[model samples]
Target: MSRIAVVTLVLHFYMAITVSTFANQTGRPNVLVIMVDDLGYGDLASFGAKDMRTPHIDRLMSEGMRFNEFYANCCVCSPTRAALLSGRYPEMVGIPGVVRTQPESNYGYLTPDSVMLPELFQKAGYHTTLIGKWHLGLAKPNRPNQRGFDEFLGFLGDMMDDYWTHLRLGNNYMRRNEEVIDPEGHATDLFTQWSIQSLEKREADGKPFFQYLAYNAPHFPIQPPEDWHERVKAREKNADPARVKNIAFVEHLDDGIGQVLSALDKLGLSENTIVVFTSDNGGKMKYGASNGALRSDKTHVYEGGIKVPTCVRWPGKIRAGQETSFTALTMDILPTLGDLCGVPLETEIEGRSFKPVLLEGKQAAFTEPVFHMWLQNGTKEAMREGDWKLVRDNPGDPFELYNLKNDPFEKVDLANEQPERLERMVRVLMVHMEKAQKIPWKRPEAQANVNH
Candidate 1:
């Protein structure tokens, strides 16, 4: 056991006393969700990362369960993050693409009607805070504090141009709640430090807390601290220099994760805190990000675009050191958390909780067809039913089919050979689109404007 873990065990008695002093739920688990941007499915040691070392994340995997076939709802950032919080398809919540500062370049907006995960946690007696990236909205109506979180200390808009500058398109998006902050540090370190500070505060307050610690690292402008890049270059001598920067960027993020996890232990919350780690989507191909032989890259509807590394850890309460082939989606996180923490599911949600799969190793019972759609490059959309996938990459083009079980890399096109399967999945896509048409994916002014 780690020294922090040892200290946590010794501090359990004090934590119990702390809990007794507050109006806390009897056994509700505190939640810590760590999400990184543009991290690929194979970017961590626990998820087949070859060039990078992610020991802190690997420890979480070894101490809990690593998901084999987990997926992000969208191939981009804002859509997937919105889906994870809303327990619905990204489009259903009015976020079908990346939310940008420039309305002309932006593709999505968070619907005002959506009831978010943080709100549910707050109502369930947990103090809620968002510690990092908040790409959902830039305006007041959709800001983090307005969206449901009690404490919002993070970036307000999309990707940061310079991690240290915390600017996107030369506009500052970093904030401490409603007040803008000009923090001096890398994006990953600042988010991690804010998380530690939040943990320290919540631990002292004796209330169960829900932390959505999102990091904007390894996204674009692959900027690693000079020393971290040098460390990677020295260790992986044969690796490409550009790729070494990506490796070092992710390694530094992993180091932040290590400190965050250590803080949980030192705060005496590790044993009961449920940790969920994942990424918004796959890495950008133009960057030195490796998708582990998966096809295409971020912004495309390939396995490489939507599939991502995901894991869960809750000491003693969860099965450790195992892997599951559950077809989990980012959307399922909200409902799964609702189930796991015994919070009431009052809102209508498209997500089906896989809580049983976590506790009992039960196979995921979600039978609905999964959709991954992106409208930025073209009218790109894909639907999955079991192992079969149908993708329509562009308008005026016929849909293509592939049996993922037989062709995981999407090397073979079965559109002609499996006409029946193609037709069936096409129908599935149409049905989802029909429902999507009812929900506006952009602001009313922008909703009428389609990219293509």
Candidate 2:
């Protein structure tokens, strides 16, 4: 070879190695957590929903590992979200129920000391953004930005009275990083667009981002765009009106998700991004939602209320087209993400990482019994220790026990049949409640003015 050609070949090899080294040093996978509000266990086509069409979500499931027994921290919105972000049980973070606009109706308050998932992402050198719902608080000291998100663009209340209006109890809760702005279009579309924008900006900036896209769709006021509703109605002419609306609503939300996924693919970020899709809780049956074979629905401590459809996708990392029955809770997500991103938890948290289950098909069982609570209206709680479950649907209701391995649907109560087991579980639950009492679910001022 000529001397000039040999020198050029050596230069090209050197540049290639330099570029590879740069990518290796800085290419931490972007984390995108798409959490839908009140999505049912059987809502997606892949999750045994024969009547619904969720192509985008189904495609995601096909390309990822589906979690058969994943659960939210609570049946209600705020508590589950609190657990998800704080990496602790909802009550431990001072959020035992929904956070509402009215102080009288609000059942929980987010403590300032709680360490959020985004805060950890920030410390790990990633740009964090939240686009969609932020139900943890409606005011300062608890807002998304205040809690550690670098950017926040979404609703700040529990649920929107109307999807387009983006209002809750006639008050506008929509915001753009703490600024109240009246954005035109449906909540789902707006959130999707904002999420795409964030992805595009992240691509340009070349910084790994942690984007929590929480959508308040198919929650209540079951409204789908007229055209989408018409499409579903035309397709399912025999379906009930309520059911048609919900199916349409969810399908539209799925399309929005598809758009975000497409943006990731288009920007060449899909291969280096970890996408987690899940819901805050089970669907509300009254609103025409399905939880498959699970018993009861939202607001109750049954399989249907807390069991959510969850999946995670990471190309070349987590194997695709996989399914696992390894039970996990929403709080576990923070530690899982920290594990994936090489970020260490700065403080102690109750969440246990399921990184092993994701990467390998290992059983990442919980050492502690899993607990679920919802304090609104009346306290309802459930505890899962291994295959056995203990449930109390209301304050005065008798505790019901079921061996989930034998009765996945909670069809037969074994509380009386297994007295010793029931007593042992009840004792454990009471101890948990005793410790949680010190957390103070209500705000200090609210507690002080009890007479008022």
Candidate 3:
């Protein structure tokens, strides 16, 4: 009614708008990506494992959304990790197979120009840290610190020969940002501890962080603590010895996960952090791992090898106890995180964001054909578009077609019955292969010579 009152009201409105804008910019959610190595689809209690217990992982799943049709970009380790961080097909980034410490055995070399996920986050004012397996590269220009992460504390090699010893081929690849250090304790426990420490330090700094906590557990050499192994054996009297070891190993890893999640809760970061749990590939069946009813196991182009259990939890944002059958590859995670964090990806990438699926609880319709390849053991490859899948188990082998919607287990082959569909899919696969051929998977000759 008065001039002073009207001006005062306008000033209040302007201040409110400014404060809201500042909050939107500074209140970006923290991201924690927990990736396990060679975990099976049917390995956890929540996913349908009757023999194994994973209360921590199951609880996280119950608090978030589960992706039933999630897949690794490849059937192996390095490639899928490469695809995940770079938001591109592994082959496009010079990683179609494993990256080993041995020069002759290494199959992938991360190109220097590829923009990693952490780099994008760092540009968006987030502190990036990687506290686990750095299988992408062992040396400069590709290592975690060299790429983007502000902190790196983990194993640099592909796999450790012994979890307690933390050595690969008698050489230590464990490092704290380029400095090799031999830390005592099991690898799982050490990683878990380091992750919590990082979170605590970051919390003190009062900045959002993107942490990738990777664990190499339930993998080969199925080593669990004696107590855990004994507990499993005591509980499952009729289970095989190998199965008992695997179950114990997984349960121990689950406990470490619980510790990490508990730390988040105590730190009061759970409400604003986005927690993601997934595996690089499927389980190695011979090592007492199960892929539910999926056909085949790791290293093969089947549901078991490529498909993985994936879930995301963001309190107050993603609804709890939800699941979706949206078929998505691991590469999609980068773009999805970018979308959620309000980061714009300036460079081109093949991964499409699935943000709508996470927030809306709906399957995002994806028509793009997803392709997979592993250039080892005869170059197994596969492609899927919608519900139809085309798989070539080896080089020079006839492609088998399957309607995954009907025969998810790949019990009956529809190759002969659907010749036209098979041919069309093959053509698409050939085009992808042609593009992949242009990218060199091996390190440059000079770089290889230097490493050797």
Candidate 4:
């Protein structure tokens, strides 16, 4: 958010266009995407947080390009995950909101026809697996195995009430494939070890792999290992209770990440792997989370709600310590990976690959800026056209506009002054909203249960 950081980001991308891109390069790198739940933009040490240490994740930002203006497709989990995998907005795929375990609270379902990232990689002869958090569906058609992931070894619910129990409302959601078996460790630790084991298997099989290691951590229940919790309290001494728990939980997550990264190095897979770390959305402000100077937190389309810390690390492909202010969405990951791995998608998607930006330093210029709308029961909507953004909190609410370039925190309301810009973004948003009518989000049988 600093003037210098902005300046450096622009210069970095503008000069990158002259460099060669990695999309056309040989040797497809193993893709390992690490997505954490509800991590705020300022949660990482590299993002200028002085209160905690996240050296493992911070190393990723330093080791590769850190996207300063990265935005998650939605302010919540399931939708963003849908967008990230499908390379399209969540609503476009019938996921305008969270995919809860209970039918009544569930807001979205992965469209049966949509092509996902792992499918593209699978077509390219890559072994794909998802080791944590598969909230896209709780049953048959939408399971990870059905959705192109070769294997699924994690919980299949929204958020676990107890990290240890891995349950939601007393139902066991843990699974290793179709079998319901209870895992014996903290969720974060189990996921990390599973990822390490996956890497080891890749080395043994000698196959290119795509592992989506999503972690449900530091989100709620705010559970950290007792040792980690005590250590934070010991070190920070009388820190705010909420801050202490959050810091400890996030730090523990970071340590797990370190273990995963270390596995890559030990397996000699570091150089040949493209590792990306990002969150589903920004942190919850009221929950001892900080989004730095950004406006609001999760569930709203404000910067704090949608903006996230994103970094990509591929040893020889992407240069170290590079940063870009590319206004990219979680949806962009699909097309970007497809192009990078020489695997083109057959299904249509709204995402644009910033491969040129990543490889050659070209700036991501959009004719129509990407969107950030979360209509989970008609709660929030946001659209971006360049630096201009439009947001509204609830259904039938008056829209507010802000020029994010000048006011990163969204402090100024330009809705009255920039009528033309607001109208333009609204028109774009409406067009996308209209398209959502084409898909049925839930089963007809569940219709009676879902009020929204």
lDDT of 2 by residue, 176-227 (tens): 9979999999999999999999999999999899999999997998999999
Q: 175-251, model 4: which lDDT tens digit per residue?
A: 88888998788999999999898899999987899999999997898999999999999998977999888999999
Where does the lowest 10-residue lDDT sum fall in candidate 4? 17-26
What is the lDDT, from 0 to 100, of the residue 264 in candidate 3? Answer: 98
lDDT for model 4 comes to 0.87
Task: Tell me the TM-score of model 3.
Answer: 0.93
Q: How many pairs collide in each candidate, listed in order?
A: 0, 0, 0, 4
Writing each residue's lDDT as its tens digit, candidate 1 over 256-333 gives 999999999998889889999998999986788978889988988889999998889987767998798888899999
Worst 10 residues of 3 by lDDT: 442-451
Off by over 4 Å in 4: 1-26, 447-452
Overall lDDT per candidate, in order of appearance: 0.87, 0.91, 0.92, 0.87
lDDT of 3 at 68: 91
Better of 1 and 4 by TM-score: 1
Candidate 2 wrong stretches, greater than 4 Å: 1-26
> For every candidate structure, what is the RMSD over all alpha carbons to the true structure, in angstroms?
4.6, 2.4, 5.0, 9.1
Q: Counting only residues 3 or more apart in sequence or on different chains, how many pairs clash (N, Cα, C under 3 Å) in candidate 3?
A: 0
lDDT of model 2 at position 100: 86
Model 3 residue pairs with clashes: none
Evaluation by TM-score, superior candidate among 3 and 4: 3
Q: How far does residue 356 in candidate 1 sit from its true spot (Å)?
A: 0.8
TM-score of each: 0.93, 0.95, 0.93, 0.92
Clashes of 2: 0
lDDT of 4 at 365: 78
